[model samples]
Target: MFQGRRRPWAAVSLFATATCLLAACSNAPPPPVVSEPPPDAPSTTTSAPPEQPMPVEVVVGVDELEGGFNPHALADMSPTSSALADLMLPSVFRPAEDGSLQLDTTLMESAEVVPGTDDFTVRYDIQRQASWSDGAPIAAEDFVYLWEQLRSQPGVAEPAGYRLIEDVASRRGGKTVEVTFERPYPGWRTLFDNLLPAHLLRDAPRGWSTVLDDGYPASGGPFAIRQVDLDRGEIVLERNDRFWGEPARSDRLVLRAVDNARQVEALRSGDSHMALFGADAATMRSLEELGDTVDLINMPRPVTMELLLRPDSRGMSDPGVRGAVTAALDRNRLVEAGTGGRPAGQLPAHAQVLSPSEEAYRPTEPPGAIPPAPDPQRVERLLTEAGYERSAGAWLRDGRPLNLVIAAPFEHESYIAIAETAAEQLRAQGIQATVVTPTGDQLFGDMLAADPRSTGTGGAGSVDMAVAPRPAGGDPASMLASAYGCPGVSPGGETPFPYNAAGFCDRLLQPTIEAGLSGEVPFDKVSDEVESVLWRDAVAVPLYQQAQVLAVRKEVEGVRPGNGFAGPFSTAAQWLGTHADDDGY
Candidate 1:
């Protein structure tokens, strides 16, 4: 539920930026002096103070680094970069274990929606004590600088909500920032999660995009970059002594890059302490044999595999036909066949657009929808009611065979298996259906190729259904809008995003999608409206959430992976090398 407007809140002052004593003091700096007790007055002291604790080193494994660490650019963004960014960059709010947003007091003091203000204004105050690794104060200008750099860049993909930001004004001597949006944006908290140092980026030679690489940056998080050896495929981070909040428990954290196949071996050989693994059923069973030496952790991914129905193609144009087809298929059977005996713990998806673990997850299908067993009789009845009749062992409508070709990409084994199972089931239900495995481009882009007579490559304007993955990240509404609600498929659009498979275009649902992205409406209400439209139209049949598994050594402590964004390292600062009570070295 969305709460109403609240009163303005105040924050306690943490630190003040002090000026150098005397304007001319910088010409010749003062000498360093130790604060030891005077020689004449030190006789009363007992024994010397205890020695400081040594830093703990944590070795983490990943598939590989994606070349850079800039959160704004796509080329530099990867799972490895994101894992490090969650620890190195400042965020106003963070996702809790249950998928709720909580304020990170280290970076931000207080953030609230300003009441009686139009166009959805949010006021944020930064913690005065926060400073970058280079000792520059973290101020409002950093937030403003990030917005200015990302507004028109080609490398920045997710810029819809940011484009709506009219201005970000600094106030109270750089302690606060007021962001004004052109329209209400509900997902504003998702913005400015990673702010770069304005002093470092303000005068870059080539620009911000080219300045960031996989190596290091002037970051302002709990940990700072210590070493980056791409040749050795390892990145090391040490605790930032300048950090103002509770100090990081582990003094040193190392991320080692390894191939997915070698992850388990690396863990077993003691090359890495904690490694990310895609443990299938057999792998998990084998890992269970390791006893108390290791522990396996599984988290649900935000990606969902679904069948995209193209209404522009034949047989699938009618909503009734699509509904009947959806009822005739079993999602669980598809998952079982597609996964090929791998125990990623895939669960059948019911909520249309939201993940099962998300707060807004709810069934969008009507009451008593989708019986336990797929009813072939019900499917036939629905098709008959929609002006289809059985003729010569195939369903026919308007003097043509109700034949459809499902275009499945062989990029992965699961896609082909799902398509084969679907084709077999549809044929049993009296529909003439077949599966055609094509290249990635023909399956997703140019399915309706210009040349209808070409063979062996192009879909030739004959594909009716496609099996693909839909992605959902920090904000699902933005991704859902681009996938479902649109100006139909753009024939001459940009590359990579050539077409919208479903070609679902509903003018009525557009406003709700915008409101959802704007945060003008509660997420539950927004999800309800958007999912209702998707289910009623049978736009796409969602099967299940993608599988994400990780293997951790029992010696690791306090690291947990959430299903969505910010993988296992989201809590890296709390990690320890051994149990709290352990005394053995």
Candidate 2:
């Protein structure tokens, strides 16, 4: 009976367990159900990244990239050289729009004429933060190097300014420059322009001529040379990250040397953003055909186009022959031809040492008052006086024909035009004249720089006369000395190469020129007399101020006409490319 009771209890326990399990199953939560996505549904896994903004670059078209880009050297004074200097070099003073000297606060803290000084002194305090692209401080050593080089180096620009400096005293770890001049220099503002890097160029292997020929050793301006592919006629400048002043608006400035036609085409096709070149009538017309696509302006360069008679050349050695050559050509006609009838061509430069654009320019008449018009009779008389006789419509002396070889730099378009026109005029007057276009170096450095006393007479590859630019400087006295001074002699009695372009030196007048430079005699007092001497000797015939046409595309911004003294390159740092994005898209 007890075993039967236990079996009944087990069955009841099993029934209770089944009831509890059913109650737990009824209270539990249900599993989630997922639906299928549509075939055309957009992605939900990830969103697209933001678009990146493009870098801004401006491409400029020019005539040629002929280098040897030492701005102070006469042989390297080309548009390319000047542009590169303006873009990459530093200056304590820069020309304002009104042609006044303005201190570049970016490079200097202060540059002033020291007060209470009997000796002319200029105190320059460089910005301590001003450092070259290579991380070297821009300091007094640069000034000392430039002063020493300009004072002693031959064929340098405006050496007289540096020659007057007695000493360059540096203080405050070279950040302060104290320049003591032998005498008062009113044109002190003109010194120390385009200051080069002393640490790189002081003992350069190739010297001054080749120091910055291909590319800059370091940059002190907003732009630094990135690449200089002379073979491809291109120079690329990129922003200098180390620049202490305002950064360049554009990332790169590419200068491409191309022909006029190609330049116009490039501008039209959006390949070039601007063009600065010596334009002719045909080139101007082609640029005009672009209509509203470009804004064109005439930029007067601080250079005077002049015909130089090499006094040391065979026939030119005779003053009478030089005068005859001058009498045969018409200055007005040459000006018209050289400028292609541009109204902005400065009035025929009347002074030899100063261009018409200069503030101190004064017109001095030639001695013995000759008419400005072409005088065939005067030409004939002068030639006859020089012991030449007319034989078969040609001037002949000692049974030899008077054949003159006129030279102009092959890279200069306006100079070539002037040379060709002058040659034609000479040929029309029964004078045998031919034009030779050699490189500027061959003409200026090799041929014209030859000392007449040593070279003797004409030889093969000799240039009788040349059509070249008379570089106009800030100091009139310095300009006078550079163009006409005698070869400078060192204290050791050694003469460096001559910088005189005329190859004519008068010992008597040199003292007067020096006096004017040394502030012993006033520049105004000696200018007329000095000019008279140059004119009487027939050293050079001034044509017109050299100028270039600047055509900027409509898309470019922050590019306006610059002062005649400084070309568009002066404000290159402010230029903006068309692709410049405000939103950094």
Candidate 3:
């Protein structure tokens, strides 16, 4: 039923075509017709045979399938495609429970950092037994080819660590690779994450961008693409027989693109085995509506929803005002209101550099030993001290009402609720604030711009505040390099300068951030120093860590909740198929 190539092997020639037309072949004895067993017949064998169970198929629901199958393509780096990449691609390194990078023994036998050089060098011993589904052996050349493409080619959004590699040589007759970096790249483990088969992609005609648009030619992971039907809004993946590791438990996997509103219905009607989406108000209602049909699993996300303020704005330019706003907000109440009154089990965030799930995270607080609670009196004192007076239930500075504009995403339903709640809190303290739901381009481009001249079509003069999610990868240094470093600093200079939307930049902290990113300084020391700056300046106010929620059917098994880059399908090889008679996972 699939409309694409089913397997890597060539089509088989079952019989000789020309000789079958001969008369001698036609005159050969006709095969006798097989007879069926009689209905009343007894057991013919000595004993009755045991019944065999059928192979299982799993259906996973997603928000949409808007991108291509090419994992290397920039457009396919969206959330849905990233989920699919976990099934078809093999990574040499994976994130451990403590948010640290660990080498995957299935792909690499060993990885060690070589010393005694000004530039950093790491040697990776590839597993000789690992091979792609197309039958090509996974070798050092795959890494070399991927590195070359990422460094020289276009379309890759973040090629930071890979660009620093001066050379990648194949030693031990192509079984090992020696990567010598031009600079110290502490996040080297995140590079070459999804290696492509060198034999298929090395000499690609359409280059890296469009080569795999039709579908992957081969896969190194547990599953391979069998069909991609855009019309039906589904992609079917089959177990890859050429996989060297443990084979997948399920026979087939179907990723369905369903709307957020219809996901609960799909699970209850037996159309989907699992679904993960934003825990918004509608999803909360749907979870209550679904009742006992599906189970909801909530986990901490490596993302944070924070209020990013523009220091160049009206009253927000003052550090006292920023501190007052931070003190006025009760993060515990905001967390409950944001997640529909705590059924989702979300946690309030205290630090921006690391999530509570991470081991290196520390609770950052302002100096002077103030209690961590809403202080209305302190808010009035700070406002009155900053050339403002409370008159007619409004704070007026220089004969003008102190008005603040908060921008949030128009598409994210949860963000809208958070913005509304924050606006109400600000207004309760005699500060006039308005929440505006703007497009992503307007929010990220115009409102979050470093220079006012580059504002987008939104025409927003000065954006006082915006609420958005910040991605924190396995390495915190790599994530916070631009935001926490100096005015013009990044990890290996991968991103542009002025990355922090809050416009909080300190020249003294640049060396510390750089040292942390390059592994020259201890992480604990860097974190302590960074926390002091964050708490003292009131750089950004963290609301809560976003929660990744999943709705799974009762019959499904081996559903491991994932954080950071890995999704639910990361451990597909160990997943068991769902059965109708099974009670629960």
For residue 505, what is the lDDT in candidate 1?
Answer: 58
Q: List residue ranges in candidate 2 displaced over 4 A.
A: 1-51, 115-118, 289-291, 312-314, 330-347, 360-362, 365-374, 398-405, 413-417, 420-424, 427-438, 456-463, 491-497, 519-522, 580-585
Q: Which 10 consecutive positions of candidate 2 have the poorest summed lDDT?
A: 1-10
Per-residue lDDT tens digits for candidate 3, residues 120-185, read: 899999888899888888888889988876654433433445555788999997889999987788
Best by TM-score: 2
lDDT of 2 by residue, 264-320 (tens): 999999889999987777888989999999999877777788888877777688889
The TM-score of candidate 3 is: 0.68
Q: List the residue pairs that clash in candidate 2.
A: none
Rank order (by TM-score, best first) = 2, 3, 1
Least well predicted 10-residue stretch by lDDT in candidate 1: 10-19
Query: Can you give the TM-score per candidate against the true fold?
Result: 0.64, 0.83, 0.68
Cα error of candidate 1 at position 254, Å: 3.1
